[model samples]
Target chain A: MSFHEKSNLAVLALLTLVFGVYFLWLMPQMAVADPLPPPAAVAGVLIPFVLCLVVLIGVVHLVFKLRDLKEKGEADERDRLIETRAEARAGFMLALGVFGALTLLLAGAAPFWIANALLGALVLAELVKGVLRAIAYRRS
Target chain B: MGKGKTRIANSIREQRFHAGEMTQQQLADAVGVTRQTVIAMEQGRYSPSLEVAFRVARVFGKPLEEVFSYEDEA
Candidate 1:
């Protein structure tokens, strides 16, 4: 695999693992709550989660760069095209997710639920983008 | 009209063979693309842009028409 493909795979794996654990922990609390958990409680979890994710992703990319020093170059035309197409599709996914979150808000859902819904939408959109890019790279 | 049904066909592989058995990576470097892009083009799974087409033709010292041909699948 090219360095880009390998890097993409690594990032995708990290996103899945990190967010998967986060949602698994948060979902149970959400279900048991009347409307939503306290914002402070959610923020407490989120701050650390974001910090850890950034650090982990940074380390992963550093390792990839170190391993593939020769493969490093600016993205060429094909790479740009693949990324553009993937982001376009992911944009649609984000739009759909935002619409759903807005509907929840209209129904008088808690701020916590809306916030999480938006966050979930963003994460899912990113996942979709990553998967599509991977497929494009494979087929290319 | 469908995926993988591109009307454009290329003689990149044959040209590469004539050009001293040029490796895909070498051609890609000459044309400023990734080796995977070169592979995709050779396999007819991808169609490059016009600029890239010209670049590839130039790399092999051939006209664009000699390198790439269009098939009217009407």
Candidate 2:
């Protein structure tokens, strides 16, 4: 796998874990009836997010370890071709998310709500495609 | 662009191999592609441009039809 694909995979994993924690633990515990838990940043969430970020950065370096400060020939023709195609697909995902959000805004949704919705959708699509690309590259 | 059973001409590569082996990377270098690209072509993961295809034949001092062939698949 190329560095581009590896970075995408790490980001996808991080997004899923963080969002899953939000839905399963933080939001549910806050919405519980008995005792409204004080909002606290879970060490669990923070740790994994930070760790994933650090590891992603590390992997990016590892992927480009050779070459130079001016890294040429880090990727061959096939890598470049695959990357271009993947980016085009990811861009379509972003565009679709933005279009849906704009439709909501036109229907009189709160501007902030629309913005948040758009951001969430974009992140989800980005994560999913990153994962799919990783799979596609392997299968290819 | 299309994926199907295609016949590949392996003879030019065979002719280039005086020692019975020619590294894919060496041909890729002469054809201005990466070794990964060569692997893709060999594995049918990608198809090269017409110019690159011709260059690949030239690298082995063979004609294009001798380097690649066409086949119909069901």
Candidate 3:
């Protein structure tokens, strides 16, 4: 795999782990049998903490890998083209998600729902960009 | 995945072999590309831009047509 593809895979794994831990494990555990669920402020702090931890781990791992390879990181023309196309697709996905979030807010959805929707959209956009880049690398 | 859909084919691998068995990394360094890009071009999985194509041809001291050719699929 190219460095970019490996980097994308690392990021994808990190996002999956972070979101899975936050949504499926942490959030559910926080509300179990509790009459008063924790405030959004608690969630906000914990989520950022978890995200930071995961991102740090990913950066450390990538750094080690790069050291082992002894590669001076540089993207060539093909990489640029793939990134350009992937970002274009991801940009559209992000715009649509943000618009959907706005619509939900206009329809009087809860603040929590709007926030989650917007966050989910942002994550999905990054995920889409990574997935499309990996696919383009393979298919091309 | 098949040659039918391929728009271009190249003899980079053969040319590199003739040029004292040059490594893909060497070619990539000479042509200002990543080794992975050179690998893709050699495998006919990706076509380079016109500028990159010219660079590759120049490295091999050959005409562009000698290194790459367009294919029209009917």
Tens-digit lDDT track for model 1 on B4-61? 6477899999999999999999999999888888888898878899999999999999
Error of 2 at B19 (Å): 6.2
Mark the regions of model 3 whose C-alpha exceeds 4 Å error after superposition: A28-43, A50-58, A61-69, B1-5
- Docking verdict class for candidate 1: medium
> Which residue pairs show collisions in model 2?
none
At residue A86, candidate 1 shows an lDDT of 88
Give the clash total for candidate 1.
0
lDDT of 2 by residue, A1-140 (tens): 44455556766776677666654575456445345332243344445655765776576566565533333345655566666666777788888888888898889864444654575676667676776567555644
i-RMSD per candidate, Å = 3.1, 3.5, 3.8
Each model's fnat?
0.48, 0.22, 0.52
| Model 2 stretches astray by more than 4 angstroms | A1-55, A62-77, B1-20
A7 Cα displacement, candidate 2 (Å): 4.8
Question: Which candidate, 2 or 3, would have the higher TM-score against the true structure?
Answer: 3
A84 Cα displacement, candidate 2 (Å): 3.8
* RMSD from true fold, candidate 2: 5.8
Q: Largest lDDT belongs to which candidate?
A: 1
Worst 10 residues of 2 chain B by lDDT: B1-10
What is candidate 1's TM-score for chain B alone? 0.93
